[model samples]
Target: MKRKLRSGITASLLAVTACMALHSPQSLAARDAQTILKETCQGCHTPEADNALSRISHQRKTPEGWLMSIARMQTMHGLQISDDDRRTLVKYLADTQGLAPSETDGVRYALERRLNTVEKFDDQTSQMCGRCHSGARVALQRRPAQEWERLVNFHLGQWPSLEYQALSRDRDWFDLARKEMVPLLAKRYPLDNPAWKKWQASAPKAQAFVGDWNFSGHLPGKGELAGVMSVTADGDDTFKVSVKGQYADGSPFNGDGSAILYTGYEWRGNVTIDGVTMRQVFAAQGSAMQGRMFEAEHDERGLDFVAAKQGSSRLLAVQPGYLKAGTETEVTLIGSGLSGKPNFGKGVEVLEVVEQSPDRIKLKLKAAANAQPGLRSVMVGSLKGPTLSVYSTIAEVKVVPAFSVARIGDGGGSTPKVQGRFDAEAWGKGADGKLYRIGVFPAQWKVEPFDDRAREDEDVKFAGTMQADSGVFTPGDAGPNPERKMSTNNAGNLKVIAAVDDSGKSLTGEGQMIVTVQRWNNPPIP
Candidate 1:
């Protein structure tokens, strides 16, 4: 199995590829997809005893995973195929061998391009398999013990230095990987499962996502935003998408795009707004959808989004859910089937109804100076669980990501600079003296040396500059800078600071930021 999968390949040369978007399988297209896969993969992934492709049929993975497999074949092996046929093969294999929703629970971050995540796993899997890449790459697949063992041998063969690596040199890596890791992985992530069987028999159709959807999300640099996403059926398992929304700062966030659904629930969209193109990756389930919308060029800059279908009575979230005591402001509730009177709990009064629709409702609400200061549930008709916070003062301010990394690039180079985005999360002390979240608040941003080493190296002066209004830290150019003491380029360690004015005092929050170099080996799932 290892030889069949790794034929004519080096581990270092298995480059990543673009993700896949699939159409519903028809008899004719299905045959074509299978023929393409067989013609391209049969050379090395030869027929097995059961007449199945040896290595390919023994495992299951995500669409991104499947794409990576094919990409490795193209990059290392001598497989020659057209772009359309490759796309067809990917769609076919992913639809047939994709993991069920439950199996993908903790590993979706890999597919979402959230590369900054820190993963914690058991020692056996982490050191043996994921020392060179993300542990998520391992968790995103399902294989029997035989396949897992073969994969271990392939790693040893393709990368001859596997035994000389740090973790390998410390232990019997090959022996442990074959004997212990194989059984452990097979037991933990077996190829055949009840969930996959059920999903294959009754998967949701792409047409289920048609019509309008009310969504809410928090962009790292841009505060909270609420919007309406309109998805129209453009073809089989594809959509024409458009979104119109406003940030908490009143800036417009609108876009027009097209989307293609893969494996029923994987929704991928490419949208252009004011000429800038962005991509949206979402998972549609029931009457709700959740995902990320990111810049096509800078995938690191994106939003965490959640939305509800226009017909459901589900109350998703309250926009600007926090209100200052003694102030009246217009707040919007994002959801579906909104109706009846709006309730802001006690000590708060609904001044006037600004707008109303099945998707969203806007109202002028006032919180009295002596109002209860705490989290209160906001209910409307049958919608009963969303909360609103009334705060008299902010007790503390915390940066969203306590630690992050920013890369230097784009000095007329291919890789763009990865910005370190942040949001100032406010916390208020309620009457009970317990602290509760007051959502994201406006703040002034700056950077400073995090420690004596950073100060001595003048990291604050050389690493990057922070955007005052937007908590965005843009790193300096790629390559070494002659101005530095050691000519070490812009890479440095610094502290991100966000200062929020609360009542009469300034509340500050500090987070660590590491300015680093470009990521040259960016895989599809990394």
Candidate 2:
């Protein structure tokens, strides 16, 4: 009776185990595959503890094959198992876990879901091909069946772990995968397309100039004269001019020049020549031809000319103090004798020339009552092909000053000096509310180069500093920390401080900064 009771308990326990196995969740069963392999077959095949069952699951074979593999494992690998228990486990695996027809269907369904279409390549082939190479690399090439076979053999040799050696055992499945991939790749990324054609078409065109221009013309022996002129245009009818030039000779012709023009049926432009000022006009002739030119103040000795073109590219007449705005009407005036001339005391001369539709001319002059009023005040003018002619009474012109400033010191020096130099003598207002002269000893200071080159010579060490009129200097932040104040280390070795005008006040501001320089060492000979 005691033995019978013990047998009953044993039978009950077996029934419970079977019930648990059948009722377990899919996730639990998946985990059980790993757990069973670990607990039962991990002794001799220690490295295969976790991977053994995974390898088996990826292989789809008949029930008999599964049993045979397990039998081999037991005999060859010394996995100890009773015949009855082994038979029961084999039956359980074959019935509940063997590859079913649904397994292939599920794999196909997953591949379709991931790729969004039916593909020539199976999921396994897609993964293997994409691992070390791009899909386009294979798709772009067309190959015969033999070529593809050779390609596969080459890959098998390159990456032996892909286990192409086992292909014989799974020849049918591998062949199916390969055949699917080849055609799918070929269709998606074809070799011929319009994008390639477009790229081939556009590769060469020159660029236009859109910046400042510096030009100069000088007389022979007398002090050399230089002039600066800038040209800019608006939509189709307006143009602006700023002319600043100087003569080395001490004459009445030296002074600042300026003009403004508007275009319509006729065009109008104003100009100041040597110390003489005048206005002129033009009418459009089918093609828009409008621009202005001024012979250098000392051009009487020789033809030193400066011309700017806009609206049209036609070359107008060449004459001293000639101003043309449009295409038809031209005005002539006299610069001297303003004292005897009506409204001449104001040093401005007005001349009425033939009026063409849309063209207007006006003149202005500034002179002293005691000044000599004769041929020096009269301006003679005429028109030639595209060029307006003007005769100036004043022959010699004075020089206009051009000045530039530079800073020199240690990158972070407490006291910084600005050295200024002028082509000619210059007297100008400084930010300090004091009058300053360029090139003179008292007004302009000479700066010597600093000796910080040892540390500041690096590309990263160069930097500049800025200061405000309030005497406060704020250094900017550097690096990723946007809110932190800029540091010396964060700045480059070299520094420059410049006086910048902001909000009507002259302030010191930081200029460009350099950080550290990167150098590469040569590689050793192999």
Candidate 3:
């Protein structure tokens, strides 16, 4: 029975490729996705004699998701494939068996790489699904009850000590998951869906959507961007794209590149933003588009990209959109439309309108002493600007990264330091009898040992020192001295402490910093 099932599955995959070959004959002849899959994936995925390719056949995922699976296989099963072949397989699988647009709606924030965006999950779901991995990971899949059951078994079979892990050991995890979580998952995300049915029925032509697209974006701590992207058909599945724009600082931001629109709506492109190579992950649904443009080398340093079929109007972005509570500063607002008097929301007041134009506006503003430490809406006539973040009283101080790992060996000179930032949050008891976040506030800096063992570590004294003004840590040279354990490098773990004593309130927070060995391959990606 299992042999028959595996044979049928292999035939189904081949049949799907055969249908695609009728339209993309060149694709089949050159780097055929299905050909790569048959050669590399069928061994373990397919049956020997009585085993089925159940897991492989029954699921779908994104291109990056498939790449992760391939990477996992290489790590665990020693699966080997050339880079070219890997790319071919990933592209093919994603094109033929990827999630529908509606299916990915819940996890779009994860794909867009938004920071600190929390996923909503019920108490049971949080405990059962979100405890080990992110909610997005769980939301990205569709499985039947039996498949979900097999997945639980696969977890136990692969990692026998799973139940003994800290989070899993709190209760009878296996029993609860079997009786409760499994049913919930099966009901919420079943294998069959109307969205997938519609998507698989017909493939949309990318040429129909090719045109000049107007876009706007913003990267926190960087600046805002407004641009135009001209897209033309390159092939049946590919496009040639060019972009031109400017940052808020007036620096030229432009690029020319190509893209592949897979899964109908996933527009994956390689382009340059502000002279830096970046990858564009856009979801094109009808005339509207939204996604991200991130450094291809390092996914961090990216911006939120949103575009529309029509020209931008009344869209405003305020640069450095925040002020120290009760302090005064100049604020710049950029957009395509402007008029009459401006309204600087509550807790803030405009002292003077420094400048005004259709595309720009500048104002000197002062924040009230009792200003709210959170985002506030900014409005000018009917045009709404990007919400501004305000900081005043610091009820709590926290090192941005709760913990970090920095390496030794800086190749002489003054030796590089890790520039850490501190954040003050308005933490207080709410009327609902719970502690809720009020937002970011202001703070000061210091350092100490994280624990008793850290206290004994001489690295705090001899290894490095933290700047009082800036939270940056300057480590001493790598060594083979008699100070540390085994006379190794000046490596140790310490705590970064941030303090805030403002407006008659005192608060403090600490984070762990691990100073360790040298990193040889400091690649651009890292």
- Winning model by TM-score: 1
How many clashes show up in model 3?
Answer: 1
Predicted candidate 2 versus true structure: per-residue lDDT over 1-526, tens digit per residue: 9876564454344332332222121221223334455667555435445344433433322233344456546433556654444434544454333322222232322211121122355455456564443332344233344445555765556455664434433454346546764445334332233432342243111111111222223332223333434445532223444555555443333333222211112223344655454232222223332222322211112312332222222222111222111112223221111122223222233444322111112333333333332212232232112212221121211112111222333234332222211112222333344433221111111111233652543322222233322211122222233322342333333233333222244433222222231111100000
| Worst-scoring 10-residue span by lDDT in model 1 | 20-29
Clashing pairs in 3: 424-441
Model 2 lDDT-worst window of ten: 517-526
Q: Which tens-of-lDDT digit does each residue in 73-126 have in candidate 3?
A: 764577777555665666666776788998898687666654335568898888
Error of 3 at 2 (Å): 36
Candidate 2 vs candidate 3, lDDT winner: 3
Off by over 4 Å in 2: 1-126, 133-153, 164-174, 203-526
lDDT of 1 at 433: 90
TM-score of 2: 0.15
| Clash count, one per candidate | 0, 45, 1
Name model 3 segments beyond 4 Å from true.
1-29, 32-54, 73-89, 100-135, 160-181, 194-259, 267-310, 313-316, 323-328, 334-342, 345-376, 380-385, 389-446, 458-482, 486-526
> How much RMSD separates candidate 1 from the native structure?
4.0
The whole-model lDDT of each prediction reads: 0.82, 0.31, 0.66
Q: What is the C-alpha RMSD of each candidate to the true structure, in Å?
A: 4.0, 35.0, 9.0
